[model samples]
Each structure stands twice: as structure tokens, then as C-alpha cells.
Target chain A: MSQSLDTRSSPGATPGEGPDATRQASPAWRRLARLALRQREVSIFLAGVLLVLYFQFSNSAFLSTDNLANLVQFSATTAIIAAGEVFVLVSGELDLSVGMVYALTPFVMFFAAGAGLPVGLAVIVGLLAAGAVGLVNGVVTTVLGLPAFVTTLGTLFLVNGLTLTISGGFPVQPTASGTFTSLFGASPLAELGWAVLLALVLQFVLNKTRWGLHTIGTGGNPVGAAEVGIKVRLIKTGNFVLCAALGGFAGVLDAFRIGSIDPLAGGNDIMFAAMAAAVIGGTLLTGGSGTVIGALLGAAVLGILKDGFTLLGVSAYTFDMILGAAILVTMAINVRLSIWRDQGEG
Target chain B: MADASTGRELLRAEHIAKNYGQVTALTDINLRIDRGEVLGLLGDNGAGKSTLMKIFTGFVKPSSGQLHFDGKPVELSSVSHARSLGIEAVYQDLALINELNVYRNMFLQREPVKGRFLGILDDKKMRAAAIEQLDRMGVRIPSVDVPVAKLSGGQRQGIAVARSVYQKARLLLLDEPTAAMGAKESALILDVIQRLKDEGEMGIIIIAHNYAQIFDVCDRVNLVEGGRIVFDKKTSETSVEELTDMVVREYREARRSVQAG
Candidate 1:
């Protein structure tokens, strides 16, 4: 028995010095490289850096202050929505109605303000309306035992129709002004600040809370999570609510930044981009694990490509082809990298 | 090292029976385990060993039964209810989230929280505690930071057992602790079980197929057949040959009845 224990320590010996005397004599730099490859967010962050360099080399205007700010602001919307999408994806669910909710929120706020409510209160009403859609999505998906994809798909159309009805299918200037608009999204870099802050906070929540741990466990193995007394339904429902609310908030921010709330804004286009950012950020499409910071970096990559392409006189129509190819390649790389890591360790 | 000594009664099942609609999974089971004792449950496939274990772990409720814990009558309404009373089971599946790190899985639903913050998990503290517990049990691993999916079968089983022990479970139920394991791995598990028995702090009920292993670590054995315990005896009073013969006779009778029907 003692002999078995003595031999068992050799298989999983790490590089750094430890109590296990049977540790393998691997070089420090090699181990460091292995660690970087093991962490998905680290690899994606590197990829984002590479994309920045590629864009800067292709188009000098890509690094200008004006273009840089524009890049951050444009990607801010995708980053915020992707951050929320991480929680839902990690909890083994999907929120397809986020794009529709994004288009619907500002309209809801505009209608509320027109009805004699204060702009601040109207914004709250907008958020509440957004949260209500999320609640309906959560309840219908969980309580009725419907798949979240189907449930959110139904709400997506419903919300799109509602936004069109409320806005009379026309783009309208937002009534919000002063501190409300500035704090929300009107000022330079305001949306960027919100995006970064929300990503950091959500990343901390994912790493340092029971809520995050349970979320991972629920998605990784629902039966195991339930066996350990975790309320799987509640965790999943909460994630759905979070994803939709973030989607709605992003929509409101976009409206404030662009100075207009269009009924047709943020349809399936933005929805697919946010989803792509999450997947490119190393979040598994099948769920179980994700990273918020990775999602932000992923959004940065997309933003760089879009802005860089426009500066280089590349047509807008070509961007979609690149986006589709990027998604496929990123996912394939993620799978292949993980398999290699496993083989190296084993 | 086996001796004749009476320990405090820890758990008792009285008239326990379970039925899945018209299918009788378990019928009229009466059993008891004492603190500092290792009781082995021997059974063929579909003979109600797992059903009985599920009832004990609060995963399944018997149609008719009364469970007595610590000499007091109690009702286990859920897995958490059983765990709150210090009754934990290491199931056949191990009930582990493979994507989670070893420390996280060890603290699964009951994560240690930082005192300053309301809902923040203290990963450092959990890692330290996991190291301590695994060290105490002589279960060696590379690190607590690695995910359980990256571990061997024996190491994963060790983590499950170590988690149950770390939670201070007074009654530990192990379902097939050594199934599918190689000889070396089984020896390691049996060694841990023997060490736990020597510590004399927990009442353990182990379900195993190997008679040799049962004799090696268990103080008593119960042979479950047709959803009922047909043979109950002290391990010291029986031989592997005797138990094997009994099972063979029962199998022959079952086969004859099947042919006739």
C-alpha cells in the first residue's frame, strides 16, 4: 500500500517545487508555455493582440485616437452583451431574444417618457420592461421545461414586433438628456467604461462566488449538481435573466451613443455578433465553462477587423464572410488546443 | 485486527420497502450499522442493493419504512437533508462535476466563503483544506487546482471519499468503491477503508462484489437477494467458499424458475 502511494505521485508531478519528491524535471519555460496554452482566455487575449498589430500594419488610421475610441465604443455593445451571454452559456442555456430586447428597451423608455414620466424613471421602466421579458423567458424555459433556444426564439420575434409597434417603425431621437444620458452612454468613452467595468465585475463574480461555482457545476453536470443539493433550475433561470438584462442595457447604451433609437436596430445582426464574440472568446457553445474577459478581447478582435477593413477600403459585405470563417476557425482551434493539452498531461 | 467490541448504534432501517409503480425494488429490509463498524452489502445485479443505498442517502424514498439515525427516528426528505444529519454517500457515479477543480469539487455545494464578503468563495482556504484532508487520508494528487476530469479513476474515487470524510459525515455509504479498478488501485482504496475503520469515527456501509475484499475490510456482511437480505453473518464466521456456494445455489434456483415460467 505504501509503495502504491509512493508511485502515484510521479504521474501528476507539476513543474514547480513541491512536497512531491517524484516531480518531473521539466524546464520552467516549457511549463509556463503549457500553462498559457491551458488557459483559453490567455490564448484568446494573445490572439486579440495579434489582430491589433495586423490592423495597425495594414492601416495606420486604425491606431488613431478617434478610431481607437470608435472601436472601443462599437465593441462595447458586443462586449457587454457577450459578458452576459457567458453566464447563460456556462449555465447550459441560451438567450436568443437579447437583440430584440436591445431594440425594444429604448423604445420602451421613449414611450414611458412621452407618457409624462421622468426620463430617469422612464429608463428604469425600460429596464423593468427588459427584465420582464427575461423573466418570461426564464419562467417559460424552466417551469414549462421548454428548451431555452426555442423559448428565446419565440420572445425574439415577439419583442421585435413590440418594438416596431411602439416606435411606429420609425427611428426617433431619444428624449433623455443631461446627467442621465451622459452617465448612460452619450459621453465619449462612457460606454467603454461601462463595458470594461461590467466585464471586470462579472469576471470577479464568475471566479470568486458560490453563484459562479454552482453555475459551472450545473452546466458541467446537472445531475451531479442536483445530487449535491444545488437548485439547478434557479441557477439557470437567474442566468437567463442576467443575459437578457445585459442585452437590454446594451441596446439602451447604443441608442444614447448613436442619438437615435431605431426599431430595426440590433436585430439578428448584433445578436449573432455577440454570440460569435462569446464563442471566439473561448466559451464553449455546448456550455459548462466561459470567461468574461475573453469575451471582451473577442469583441476587440471583431471591432479591430471591422474598423480596420473600412479604413483599408474593403467593402462592408466582405466582413460577414470573415466573421463566419473566424467563428469556425476559433472553435476548431479551441478544441484542438484542449486535446493537445490533455495529451501532454496524460 | 478485527475484535469483538460493541460500538454505539448509529443507524437502523426498519421494515424498509420500495416499489416503482408495480415493480418491487426493495422489500422488507431491516438493517443496522454501529459506529466504528464496516458493514458489507453483497448482492447480484438488480438485487436491491443500490435501491436500499439510495433510500439511505435520501435520493429515493421507500414506500414503507422508518429510518433511525443516532437512535432517534428521522425522515430524510432530500440529499441535503441526509447530508445535514452527517449522512453522506459516495455514489457509483461519484457525483462530481468533471469541469471543476479538485478543491471546488471537494467543497461543491458548501463552498467556504470569505468572512469580509457576503458571497465570495475563499479559494485559498479551500485549497489548503483540501490539501490537508487529502494528506490526512494519504491520497496523493498533483494539485488541488487541476480539474477532476484530468485525474485517474482511482484518484477521482479518492476525491469523492475524501470529500465525504472532510464534510465530517458520521455515516458513510460507499457504492462499489473498487469496481472496475485495477489490483493496485483496489488495494489503495481498501487501505483507506481499513485506516478509517481503525480511526473508529464513522459507521460505514460498503456495497462490493468481491468476497475477498469484503473479508479484508468489513466486520459484517449481508447478502441481498430478491430485494431481501437472506444471509447475515459476521465476516470472521464465514468463508468465501461458503458465500460463493450460497449464491450459486440461489442462481440455479432462479434459472430453474425462469425456465419453468
Candidate 2:
């Protein structure tokens, strides 16, 4: 890194002009390249495209309409949940119970409907229950001054146990009307449509709303936020509620699409996948930066990888191994790129 | 307008004193700033200017004192309470969230809303207002879109000052506004302060180490030493050299006392 800096700082075509002037004097293509590298989502999008091209070349059936539809549906599930996770992550907190909430929400809806509540009202009750778990997560984390990781980790196990007990350790079919199911996930395009719509709205909120702005401020500098009267605790707690609610919503859609609600569904696997998607999409783990659309693209990338690997006859175990390696490689690249960007800016 | 000439008090502190356990931070401080007046507080480090300012901004409470704002005796509970009563401060740290953009920082807690049900932020309006204010203050920057962390220190300070000015509070407390600035940046801020003084609407209390800057922008200057106001004089009556000599004498006396001890 020192050697690279030495070379970068060495006299170029314009001597003693300072970094800003030299940056401006650089060739247009070099400037464009720098801009592209600076926007992490753009690079991630390009990587996704490259991956698609590689898969399509390896197997002609990779781009088949039926396969593409399946890819969209699968990616949409991760994307919706990940979008919500971005809010919590950007607000400098974590919600490990999201996956458990996903598993538990469907059962809550099933039981509520079984108790003779209207199916629509049951779904609302389920989302509200998920939100309640988040509220607990928030209250415990903030009011009790516990780290979000510990609070949510405790909730994760408790929620999982609750799901198991309530479902009597059995899978149950949902009692939703055909119209409701179709609107949510039963139709081929429904989940993807919902994902796209949610992503757009969430992106707008993150960029152009007071809540989004405050969340960023809270994560960026909690002391500063509080000093400026940004309601740091309320912003963080609200994000927790939103994150769990979105996770529950995504679970309901997935359950309807799959035709059953299982206690085992959307355990650690989906949670990890969604988190990976968020990271790959350029939301910083350390907080204060996020992108919802990037998450959608990341989910798409993961979906493509899964579909392509299966088509190429890779085993599930091998897929997991490959996914782990991919995450490490991507993270390493992200760190390196950030270092370069910082150097350039500094 | 008549208060401008009569020095009608905007905020008054009578016999204010503060102590941190056994250590006294302020002692029998009597300070007042009138409408349309700029009061410069000059002191070495730990001389209680900041503590007094914090008391005025409600970040700290005086152990024994009465604060009167606009002739109303009130107890200030918190920083927010002070702000709600139209007292705003630009502290030395500036309290800016580095990840947010300039416009967002400018409109941090008081963002303009335009949509239904927890209305969305009006970014375009904020952006335009921030730019216009910065331009008016002669604080130049490339754009309001980039994160504040990317800006230079002087630029960040400029944004902080501009934010307070745009808030248009009744009283503004600026702590070492030009402390970290260069000649050019300091000039820009001094110019803004001069403009505010010319407007003659808000009361400003500035803390500064630079005697020249205080004389350049302040109507009256107060010298703080050993947790007390040692000297108070109108700018026309006191020279920068006199203030510098007074501070130097205090430093010499303190050194002699330490050696004797």
C-alpha cells in the first residue's frame, strides 16, 4: 500500500499541481473508472451481469424463461427481507431474530385464522406479533442498555422455541383465500413484483425521508445525533420494528408460495442468505451506509449462482462451500476498494 | 430598534457560579448580551468561557445563579429546552454526523416535510436553502450532496456556522468558530459575523483566542481569567495589545505561583 501511494503521489504530467488538480487533469476514462469504482453498487451490478454471462455460456438452459421465473421468485424472497435488514444495519444495530420471526410469523397467522379470525386480520396480527418481537428487541437493547446483538440473539432462540411449541412441531397449511395467496406469492410474478415495489419505496425512504436521514445520522454518530436532537433511541427502535415486520411479511409470502407453513422454514439459512445479500449489496456492517436496490441485485446474483450451480450438477454441500468462499472474496475486495477510495479522497 | 442603542438585554445571568464537586468551574459570573450585540469572551483554556456558554445553552446548570431570557426567569433543563426557547449554540465540536450530506446536516432535526403521515424530507428545498445560505456566507464548496466526512475541516466548520445562522434563533452562541480555520476561511466567517452584526437582530456571544478577530467582529470584549471576568470593555475603548498583555500577565503570575508552591 505504501508503494502504491508513493507511485500515486509521484510527479506526473502536471508537477506540484496538488491532488485535486491532478485528478481533474487525468484522462476522462480514468475519471470514469474512478467514479464507477467509487459507487459500490455499480461494480456489484456489473459482477452480477458477468456472472449471468458466464452461467449462460456454460449452460444454454440457464436463461430459459421457466428458470428465469424461478430465479426471480427465489431472489425476491431474500431481497424483501434484506431490504428491511438494511434499515436496522444502517441505524447501527442488528436483529438476529429476523429468521426466527420469519418462521414464527406464518404460524401466528395460521393459529389466528384457526381461531376464527378473518384471514386478512390474521395476517395483520402476525405482522404485528413480529413487530412486537422487534419492539421487545428495541426496548431491551435501548432501555436496558444491552447490545443489540445479545438482545436479538436471545430473541432468536426464544422465537424459534415459540414457533415450535405453537405449531405442535408440525407443518400446517395456511387458510388464505386464493386471491390473497396470488397477490402475495402464489403467482409467478407476484413475489418479484412485490420485491421491486418494496425496493423502490425503501430506496426512496433511505434517500429522501426524515426517518431515513435520522437513521443514517444515528448510526454515523450517536452522540452527534442526540446533541442535534435527532431522537437516536426512537430512530433505532423504529428501525428494529420495521426490520422484523418486513421479515414477517416476506415469510408469509414465501409460505403461501410453497403451499405450507413449517416451523423449520426460514431458519438460520434464509437469515444468513439475506444478510449476505445486504453485505454484497454494499451496506456497511459498521453502519451509516446502505442501498436497498443493491440488495435486490445481490439477491439476484445469489439466485443465479444457486440455479447455475444446480444445473452444473454441484451438490448442496459444495454450493455452501462455494458461497462461503465467495463471501470472503467479496469482502476482501470491498475492503481493498474502500482503502483505495479513501486514499484518493484523502 | 431602540433596544439596539439602549442595549436592551436579551439574556442575563446574575451571580452565576458552577462547581464540579470540589473544583469550581465558574465564580460569581455576571454576564448579559443585549439584542443586536456581539459579546466576545476571551480566555485561556479552562477559564470557564465554555462552562458559562454551556450554562447559557442549558447544557449545564449553574449551582447558584438566576438566568433571565427576555425578562422571564426560567430554569433551563436541557440543551433541547434551551433550543426550544430560541437559544442555539455552535460548539467547538460542531456535532455533525459525518456520513450525512451537507444539506442533510444543515437540516438535521428541523427538516422540512412535504408528504403525508410522517412526511418525507424535502431534499430539494433543503439543498437549495443550504446552497443559498452557504453562498451568502461566502463559504464555498463544490456541492451539498457529498458526505461531510469528505469535506475539509474549514468547510465543515462553515456548514456548522451556516446551519446556526439559517436556524435564525434569537440568540447564537459560537465557541471558537475560527479556531481551526486558515486566513481565508477565518475571513469568510468573520465576514459572516460582521454581516450578522450589521443586521442587528440576533444576540451573539463569541468565544475566541484571536484578539484581532474579536476586535474585528465584536462590539464589546470580556476577558476571563481564573473562572472570573477580569476585564470588560467596549471595542472602541480597548486595544488588542492591552488584552494580549493582560493574558500574558495572568500567565506570568500563574507560573510564579506554581514555582512558589
Candidate 3:
């Protein structure tokens, strides 16, 4: 009975029969290019490459294996946090507390270490502490129906203050140099490889799993998602927790890698950079869609740009100006691509 | 003849009333649909039609109501619970994620899972099934992989309807399915509704202002006014002219009262 219409109509008529015929007839190459442009990450990746090449030409040391390794190590923390930002952004939430979480977790680990806990156990506690902050952020924003930006922003300062109080406003220098630090805070290449691995797994989850699908749906249309039986609030809360947990994890990894924990190391600056990386990578702050791998490329762009400027004797102030310009140019291109897609097919 | 469809109650709502703080959204609403029934709910703006549908779909809690589904009294605690009982509603927005591709939007939170205790979405199965299911419903989209935002209104509506049917919804609520649709698109929805009605496993309640359109697909039509059902009649007992006359009469009376006030 359900198959009645299938037999009645021609078995295989495509959906293109109705909407704009000119678009249906557009050249395959043009369509392909438009598709590529629609993906903002591709352009961002190309921009990153161009920036790298420009630096390599400007200074021979820019592309050296050691310098490249340094770039990876420097970008890994921001990239790790960006992965979580991708989750939160795709689920239609802002996580402004990520930087403070990053700064605070290492101190949590340090205090736990001082209390005679194993490094592994301390790391776990630190991550849990970060996740707890995320839980508070999620509950306050979701359950209480508070605005996400305001809620997370308040939590950011609170976490930063807590970090200062816990570490007494001082950097907790590493007390032990052992396999624990070597394993987690390995050489730049190894840490970068691990970050990439985590990113790819998260990307798979975001693009493939039901949780990822629900997250996208929730962000795309909260009412529509709810109408379709999706747990929209739950998805948002989960993303919030995940974003904070990843931030905490990044702090732990960096502390172990650098052989010290600085309570004042990362502030709102790290959060802003991570958010910028996600945005540059094509993750819309407006939510619904983003790229995980794009975040890595984005972090690399910022990391390389900062390092290249220092190598080129450019002032620290100039770095912000260049980054701000890159964002405007990328966003302008993204808007143009969107306009093209709408005019082309819609 | 026992009139099996009319006798077998699929869903029943009694004395359903809803209050949003100081405002009353619905009051003294009694409604029901039986097996293989197509019930058309007619209402003006703010007549609480959508609110009632929301209550049915478990998106809102009624202050007081008793709902019987498939002869069992049940409280719909959540949208998922409603879905589990084979009740689904497609709103005027179509409840579609425009950014997502047709297949992904169709599956949404209910993707087909395969490996490791359903840990992974079986894309191959989902894509194949999306194509087959859409094909079965006679909805022609160029590709199942295309984003829904790119599809025509008719195609998007078809995808929404096809999704509900594919997911095994036994009681379907369609809020103004043909509101913004073109002639051909409206006909497509009517055909889908008629086909579903004929299948006898599903009962559909459609909210539409068009009396003629409702007459074309519905087995019965209920007119609501002031948050209550004012009149109800089977399609067999009501003609297009009679419905038009009654509605026009009601409109004129409403205008007179407003002018007097």
C-alpha cells in the first residue's frame, strides 16, 4: 500500500525538475568551484598556506623543521580548545570561560600533585574541575534560561579569579621531570599529532554520530529540533561541558609539555584566539555548521602569524592588526560565497 | 458494517485546557481521531489550533486533560515519548533544518546506527533508505544529499511528510501543510494525505483554513472558535457550499460584534 505512488509515477525523477532550471544547467566546473567556495575552511586553509609561504620567503628559518615543530606545539593548546569551541558553536552556544578553564586546570593539577596524588590522578581531577565549571555554565544558561554569552562571561572572570586564589597569583613550576610529563607534554610533533588525532575523532563525531546530528539540528532550529523529538537543551549542555573539559585538558597537556603551570598564563586572550580560529576555520558564531579540521588550520594561521611577526621584528601590537584584517577579509569572502550559493541555486 | 475506522479510536483528548500564566491558550477542548481518519481542523488566527497540536505532540503541557491513545490512557511527558507512541506533528515551519542535507534532516536525531551498539551512523543504509522512502512517496528531489534550503517548497514539504511516514508515525499532525504551497505542491500534499488515509494504519489531523482543500482530503472537519470546537461534521455530510456559507456567516457576525464594541 505504501508503494502505491512509486508504481504510479516514473520511478526516478530527480528533485531538480522544479527549482531554477538555469542552476540545474550550470556548468559542472562552475558548480564544483561554488561548492568549494561554500566551504569556508578551504579558503582559510589556502590563506594559511599563503601566509606560511610568505613567511618562508621572508625568512629562511620560518619553514625549518624545528620552527615548524615550535609552531605546532604553540598552536596545539589553542587548537585543542578550538575543537571544543566547534562543538559549542555548532550547538548555538558561546563558551567565553574556555581560557580561564585552560589557565585554572593546570593549577588544579599542581595543587593535587602537591597533595601527593599521582600525576595521572591530578590530571583527571584538573579536567573534572574544568568540566564542573562547564556544568555550572550549562545549568545556569540552559535551566535558568540565562543568555549564554552573559553566563559564560561571568564564569570566565570567576574561574580566572579562582585560578589566582588557588595558585596565589604565581606560576607553579614543575616539581618532577618524569615519564608522565614526557608522555603527555611530548615534543611538538607528537603533541600536534595527538591534537590532530583528537580533532579527527571529534570531527567524525560531529559529522557522523547521532549526537552530532542532534547538535546541528538543535542549533539550526531549537523549536524544530524539539518538535522532532531531539533533546535540544541536553545537546547544548553536553557541548558546554565538552568545551570546558577540552579546555582543561589543553591546560594539563601544556603544563606537562612546558614543565610548569602558570595561573596567569592564559586569560581571555586564549579564548579569543580559540574563537577566532574556529571562526576563521568556517565555524559560524551564529551556529548550525562548522569544521573541526578547519580549527587546526585556523590555530596554525594565528600561531604562525604571531611567531613569524616576532621572527621578522614586527611589534606585538601589529599582530592584532594583521589578525583583525585577516578576519574581515575571510568574512567578506564567506558572505560572498553565501550570496553566490543563494543566487546560483535558490 | 461495523465502521471499523470510525469505531476504533486512535486518539482521544478530553477537556484539554492550557494556561500560560495569566493568559489562557486553550479551554474546554475535546477532540478525537480514529483509525484511518483524516480530520481537518479549521480555525482563525489565535484560535488555539496550533496550541492544541502542540499539546498532542507533547511540546507543551496542558493544565488539565486526559489523553487516550490506542485505547490506553497515557500522559505524554515529552516529544520523544509522543514519538515512541507513534504520534508526530509537522508544524507550519515544516520542522526541517535547512542547513542539513535532505537525508540528514529526514533522519535528524534518528539516524540509522550500525557498528558497536549503534555508535556509528550507517550512512550507506540511511542514504539508500532515504532514496527508497522518498521514491516510494513519489517525491522527486534531484539528490537526497542536497541541502533542503536549495529544494523547492513542494520538495521540502514532501521531505517533511515523507520523514514522518518513514519514521512510522501512526498519528500525524500537519499544521497548514499547503499554506505557502503552489497549486501543484498543494496537490502533492493532498495526494500524500489521501494515500496515507487509504493505508488505514495512520490517522492524520490537518489544520487548514481552506474549506475546499480540507473537503478534498479529510474524512471529517472540525471548526474551532474561541478556543472550543464550534462545529464538527463528516465530509460525507457536508458540502463545499454549506461550509462556505457557515464560515461567511460567522465572519460577518464577528465583524458586527467588533463594530458594536
Candidate that beats the other on lDDT, 2 or 3, i.e. the better one: 2
Model 3 chain B: lowest-lDDT 10 consecutive positions: B1-10
Stretches of candidate 1 off by over 4 Å are A1-33, B1-7, B115-117
Q: Candidate 3 on B1-261: residue-level lDDT in tens?
A: 545644688999999999999898888899889989999999888889988998998888889979889878889998888989999878789889987999888887778886766368888888998999988877888999888989988788889999998989999999899887778888887877887888887999999887676587899999888788888899899888888888899899999999999
What is the full ranking by TM-score, best candidate first? 1, 2, 3
**Model 1, docking class:** medium
Model 3 segments more than 4 A misplaced: A1-32, B1-9, B12-32, B58-81, B116-118
The TM-score leader among the candidates is 1
Better of 1 and 3 by lDDT: 1
| Clash list (residue pairs), candidate 1 | none
Error of 2 at B55 (Å): 1.4
Q: Give the lowest summed-lDDT range of ten residues in model 2 chain A.
A: A7-16
Q: In model 3, how well does chain A match by TM-score? A: 0.89
Per-residue alpha-carbon lDDT of model 1 for A17-112, expressed as tens digits? Answer: 332332333355335436556676776676677678888988787889999888887699999999988999999988889999999998888889
- Give the chain B TM-score for each candidate: 0.93, 0.92, 0.92
What DockQ results do all the predictions give, each relative to the true complex?
A: 0.63, 0.72, 0.58
Model 2 over residues A202-252: C-alpha lDDT tens digits?
999998888898899999888878888888889999999999999999999
lDDT score for residue A180 of model 1: 74
Q: Model 2, residue A131: what's the lDDT?
A: 97
List clash counts for every candidate, in order: 0, 0, 2
Which candidate number maximizes lDDT?
Answer: 2
